[model samples]
Target: MKKLLLSLVLLISFLGNSQILDPVKWKTKVVQKSDTEFELVMDATIDDEWHMYSQFTPDGGALPSVFEYKNTKGNYTLVGKTKESPYKKVFNDIFEVDEYYFAKTAQFKQVIKVTNPKLKEVKVYVEYQACKEQCIQQDKTFTFKLPEIKATEKGEEVIKEEPKEEIVPTEIASNDIDSTSIKTEKVTETKATTETNKTEVSNEPVEEEKKGLWSIFVLAFLGGFAALLTPCVFPMIPMTVSFFTKQSKTKAIGIRNAIIYGFSIIVIYLLLGILVSLIFGADALNALSTNVWFNIIFFVLLIVFAASFLGAFEIMLPNKWANKVDSQADRGGLLGIFFMALALAIVSFSCTGPIVGTLLVQAAAGGSQIGPIVGMFGFSLAIALPFALFAAFPGWMNSLPKSGGWLNTVKVSLGFLELALAFKFLSNADLVLQAHWLEREVFLAIWIVIFGAWAVYLFGKITLPHDSPLSHISVGRLFLALLVSIFTVYLIPGLWGAPLKLISGFPPPMTYSESPNGVGYKNQGIVGATATLPEHAHFSEHGIVAFHDYDKGLAYAKEVGKPVLLDFTGYACVNCRKMEQNVWSKPEILPLLKDEFVLISLYVDAKEELPKEEQYVSPETGKEIVTVGNKWSDFQITRYKNNAQPYYIILDDNGKDLTEQVGYTPDVEEYQAWLDKGLKAFKK
Candidate 1:
């Protein structure tokens, strides 16, 4: 029986690991405008089971369907950008089920406008990731040329179309362009030329990009390990092992039971994964990340969790209800063991609930179909393992520390972390509302108070319902508490004037603050208690200020005759914080930001929305625009077709693209290279 069970488990594991992406056939085409301009289109014949994301998804969700046009001379304008065919599919949520999809044979097209008509041929490069039951992605490029238009007569003038003609470029027919003008047009006299240069495109079938499956596996493993430390699972290690050891009456039998416990954990976690994948689907993960309502929901949930951690309340399953389930674990079979595990899980809800909630939230927010499953599995494995290991080497259990005051200390530390994390969500809302002045100093002020109170409590200056008095202070504990208290005091200087650079990115942008000194602050850290705007603000309370929105930023730059600097940033991103401290603080970078370019720091993680009258819901994703940050974040994702934060896009007046670099590049030289690239792109 044992051998049979082991073989079955092994087979299931093999099947899970063997999952792969389905085959997809792809094709490309070029619609030329003249010798210098053209539109490039890529089409994918997705298998019946698979579908790709559309261009306008909710920010923070899936990667926006992107078109990377390479080998062009002047510039590749996406001609109002790429659009996917529409479709409909069913969605099953915990509360309700709905259906959604874009059309079949999704066509992604981009129009590339060029300068220096002498420059020949352009290569359109495209990269995308598609997933079904399993996920596989590919990076492919399409290269084509603008076929030169043959002139019917010499020295004819070309007339530019109405500005409105460029809007919705895809809907415009090829015949709409002046066929008579192409023949007579001369290069120098060309006011604006529209040439429909259609190049026959062969659809190339391609495979998905092969990811380092091992890396994903390892990350999943670490996630499981972290889950075990949560209050819910840790206590079970000893109890489960003891139960098996007592029943087995032999070391070998005990070891086998422990192994079964671990296997049970894996099975439970995998089942949860299957359910999530089935319900959310792979593509919807993207929407969850950027959807304003979803963000709001996440914020509320985290607040509840944080409050519970802080001893404001305890969240748990009903006692009579949980006890009924626990009663079933003593039947003495495989089912009984499973029930036993469930009982253990239910009992530890108070301690483990917050951690599990946090992990699950993070995993879901990642927008990977497999994320929740992998995350749960990691958590369960951590919770499951000590039982088996202790059974195998029972003597090792003696070395473990007893649960006492230290356990309460651990809980308090975690509470601190939870309270700290809650501010980030709040900050997200604050930034979107244009509630500036909540800079890093404000964040520090609150933290110092929280920690100071905590230190006092540890020293028996205060006590909570769950805490005990310290009879005698250990030297080590005294030293640690003293150090923390001193650190708390250290933050006070920041209230008046201090460069708290260590956590610059964690707060709102520095421009929001009214710090007496001229030293600029990143829009991070502290938030003001009362809602108010700067006296010179041009924005309505909800609308973006002058030089805040993209169009406005470009206009301001044009008015000032300064080059435009577009900052794609987020409220929750940790790397952005590091960049502000390490690079932005560098004397060289600081001066450049203050004087060289017109800075437009767009916050991609802001959660406040416009009033109901002004708020717009996205037709593509069925999510509302609730906050100021949400508007800009959505604009960046849907318009620019990029989601990664800490992205920098440089543009000129008339909304011309200059340079765009995403994510953090640590090397100073690499950053400098981007700086130079943007300066040159603007010049062009």
Candidate 2:
């Protein structure tokens, strides 16, 4: 009775697991479109709450749905690229990409021309993933027979159709499937490759670039709010509104003119954005963010802006241009109001210049053509709000605080922020050059000093060139000083190798630090114990003791009698850094990675030239593998059929998979379990 009860429990558990594994039913149909052409329709009837990804997923994103036609002979020719039904596009925080997925039902169609009409059937396979709480990859194949047509006595073809085959849903355990069998060769050539032959498909998800425009606009709006608090622009606000209110024929007229003036400000800034887009072109401007010299120049520019903000000097346009615009402003008309707004823009150049330059730089770096226009629209909206509001309610002017030493304080504080931001651009330049000058500790040290000086300035111990006499510090000033002091203190621990999660992206990364362990000497330092590793072993600046060469890592793993943990990562991969900081930082995962597995991280973006003897043409991509990155990129695409970053694969010394691969999973406990499973498999 006990044995029978245990058997029943085991059966129930296996059945439950199988139901969770499979969540979608797939069906295929051949729709007759023309005499020679036919549409191969692949439909997925997904289970409740489960979703499938689209085929047009971008690079550095989730795995896209792929179809492989096992075309051995030239019987049928592909018409064009496959088309998918409309899917919802959402920003996935885990993957950090705008991914497209479909729920309920999805239909993908591929048009193909039947060159050999006598051909009876063709075989095609598909690989896709479905997700709900967790994602599960699926591979399935189908064979479709050609429809038979008979000639009639009336000279019309009589078509005879066979009953469609019913598809039954099947659940397969993820670990039970072989990885090699699932990987398929990507189809390239099609008959409808020309522009005229392209099919009109409207159901595709919206482009990911368009989604980021809203974020850029929000950032620009916040920047405008910051600029409004500056000395040069803040005082001008009430003064400009007052001029319009007093000079207008009536209250309504005054409000109307003020709104027009606000709109003029928006138009002027937007034109500047358009001019920048025209000059640099969107692509080149975006490329500037990663360019070494451009980043260096931007770093210097920000420092100069910071100096000007600190009251060292002023940045202004020619006096003649301001005078001419001011003259035009004196005319009593709508045109005069525009000139008046333009005059204010020129007059406030000393303060607004740095803010505008920063906004434009960020927008340009975003790599979208409309980014600058959208950003400037948001910025101008924030700046224009107060002018229209004050003119509409003239009595509100009495509540406005009188600008004095407080304005100078604001300017000086901004100077410190600009100085801190300059270091980020400098760090970017250093990272691209692979120069270790501005490492984690050094970057934190600089920020600490800058903020510390800011705190002193707030407390009236230090002053800039344009400061008024400080008889005593106000309560607000004292509070600000205390906050700054605390922030400065907080940064000090970061120099000793704290994660400093708040400012994670600002620094050059902890891995690039001079000392990976901490500021002072440590027992298990990344560099100190490197001599223990075998010859030809390369260590990252973080001192993980890895090998850049694949063969060397596998050989070492075999020597150590351990499995290989292949980490496919990149230098510029943001999510890779995040995983290292958040997930890999866990005590359980860190030791397993450092001690047990042979860690082999292949950088898919490495630019180092390969040896002449090693360089060759990639059979898969048909591109020359001239660099280290190219070789590994081809290897990943050909072997595993994946090219995404932060990809982890646990393999035995013989290069067979010990466990299924995963990408950018942040759940530490789950990842630890995965590692344990791999280790267990290796032991077996």
Best model per TM-score: 2
Model 2, range 1-684, lDDT digits (tens) per residue? 954764464345334323324566665555555666666666667878777777754323445688887673678889866766656556554333445667777777777777777876667777776665444444556666555433223312222344334332232322122111111111221223212122222333445555668878998898788788888889887888778878988988988988898899999999998988898874465456557887898899999999999989999999999999999999968999999889988998898898788777767755556788888988888888887788777889899889888887888888888899889889877866778898788889999999999998898998679999999999988999999999899889887877676666677655577877577634454445645767777654345667888899999999989999898777545567667768776778877887888888888767699999999987765656788987886787677766556677889999898866777677787678778878999999
Candidate lDDT values, in order: 0.54, 0.72
Assess every candidate by TM-score. 0.49, 0.63
Per-residue lDDT, model 1, residue 76, is 44
On lDDT, the candidate that comes out on top is 2
Q: Tell me the tens digit of each residue's lDDT in model 1 across 315-349.
A: 89889867776778778777877777677667877
Native-referenced Cα lDDT, model 1 = 0.54
- What alpha-carbon RMSD in Å does predicted model 2 have with respect to the real structure? 10.9
Alpha carbon lDDT at 683, candidate 1: 73
Full-model lDDT, candidate 2: 0.72
What candidate 1 gets wrong by more than 4 Å, as runs, is: 1-238, 431-444, 473-684
